[model samples]
Target: MPRRGIRSWFTVRVTTALFTIPLWLDLTAVAVGAIQGAMFAARLTERRIDLLGVALIGVIVGLGGGILRDLLLNQRPAAISDNWYLPVATAAALLGMLLLRVFTKLNGLIIALDAVTIGLFGAIGTSKALAYGVPEVPAVFVGVISAVGGSILRDVALNLPIALMHVGSLYAIAATAGTVLLVVLVSLGVNVVVAAGLCVVVTTLTRLGSVRYGWSLPEQRALGSWRVWRRA
Candidate 1:
């Protein structure tokens, strides 16, 4: 009876851990973001982002989103406060820097990587916010911000135009759709892992599909610019 009871307890603990697996998504997201950041730095020779710059960008990409999300959630930013977060990010950054040269020529791969990171972060963010009992709308917003925050930081550091502000891609829209879907499903009592998987799939597909099909939001042309053009 004692041995049977111990086995049952062990099974219960393992089952609990399995259910919490979604919490680890952030780590994978950070790794992918770091790799993308390194690639971005490699591409910006004209901007003079060398090896150290690459590492800096990688670190920012890896942790920027989580920091922002934590701040918004009124929690300690794990990226800054957690020992493991820094070490993991730093190691990933160094690895990205070391691998920078080889991936420079893999055109379109960066876009794919960006899409993947967005999906991972978006799903993870929504799951976390929901777990914290955040209100539904705010949870969705958190997911969107987490999805785009790192890239915004990366662009700002590089002195590049913010990708989210542009009309060229369905970045925010994709995140919104996925996050909303996840929230809705969870509300309907879907399994968390299944919901998260679906969210990631929708986000990634929407982003990559928009890119492939040249689908973009309509640009809002400035009336003043149009008037000036007419005068000319």
Candidate 2:
């Protein structure tokens, strides 16, 4: 090969390897999310925890975020193109099913695991966007979406109120906050791994604290209707 050709090939190989970091991040996130999804399905006695239901929810929670993120970035989703993605997801789902059978009460574990995945996905997504030369603000949005998109899909699939739209444990807010923290740390010359670790701690602590303390964002009521009622 010509020297220039060799150099170009090497550059492409290195770049592709670096990009695989995000893929691995998403894969691990999907596994965690799948376990949590199965746990959630098990918790709902009404859902009856069918194998098919557990597997379906697992797949949704596993792949939905990355698919959406990739589409938004105008890149082909790794979850679809990568040969290992589906098998990993399915295997994780099966492991989750097995865990469900072993653990009689998994709610707390599920919540904790879900929080961890949120942080992982958020950090990875933000890093990816920044690597791709995305601006700070939009990168933050991408991070938040990558964190919460899977859970949102899970909610929709289960016919539950979408977690992002509801006054629940600060899901999107936690993701955004973590991603912002990560971006700031990276800008300050912190190592990306350290920044990601900090983000995971921040996101997990915030999410778990919100759930523990029953914290919620303030609700908006229709003051206009109340005023008319009082006048009448």
Candidate 3:
């Protein structure tokens, strides 16, 4: 019947949209992460990292988060299973390295992209954990790990101080906020895709605001001193 045909068409369109949106978003995250990694490596003049080293670092940054997430969940990494991921990451890294000067000049743009990258990763990670029946709190933890795992690996590889441990922009906090929001929204019957999009927006705004305002958690020593003074 005409009604049946219309319903079938709508269902097909909706299913296709759901599948394609996440795929594109994941690819976008990989590309941005690779570019950011390449730029970071290129800036470290003292390290004298070669093109291959830069590319490797880029790949690690691009794929590290998802790998960590899967490992924590006791599953094989999706990045490894998918063919598109590696090629996209490598190409993006090369592009970043080749155009280092241009990207460096657009620092603001890079920061924005970095924010978006983390948001996407966090959303994807949290959603996946929930899909696998991970509890709410642990799902948030996974999301945070996925958001920051790449940078953690990069710092370790480069022998730099771990950014998460130091006073810096609220990277983990932003991720937590976003993931929590996504969980809450989903519990409230929001569509997963729509919730994920909102999560990205919240995370992006939090990250950008933190950078603009120099917002960061108090240093450990500072917090200790405050506690001592309060006791006094």
lDDT of 2 by residue, 1-232 (tens): 2334423433454355435565576677788877777666756777676888888788888878877777778779878787988888878877887787664476677778888988888887776776665666787888888888988888988988986776655988889889999877766656666777898889888888888998887554544467645864
lDDT of 3 by residue, 104-147 (tens): 89989999999998999999888777766576788889998899
Cα RMSD to the true fold for all candidates: 8.6, 7.3, 6.6
**TM-score of every candidate relative to the true structure:** 0.81, 0.79, 0.88
- What C-alpha lDDT does candidate 3 achieve relative to the native structure? 0.85
Candidate 1 lDDT over 145-186, as tens digits, reads 899888889899988899889988798999999999987876
| Residue 49 alpha-carbon offset, candidate 2, angstroms | 7.8
In candidate 1, residue 213 scores what lDDT? Answer: 98
Quote the positional error of residue 220 for candidate 1 in Å. 1.3
| lDDT rank order | 3, 1, 2
Residue runs of model 2 more than 4 Å from their true location after superposition: 1-26, 42-50, 104-106, 222-232
Predicted structure with the largest lDDT when compared to the true one: 3
Off by over 4 Å in 3: 1-21, 226-232
lDDT by candidate, in order shown: 0.78, 0.76, 0.85
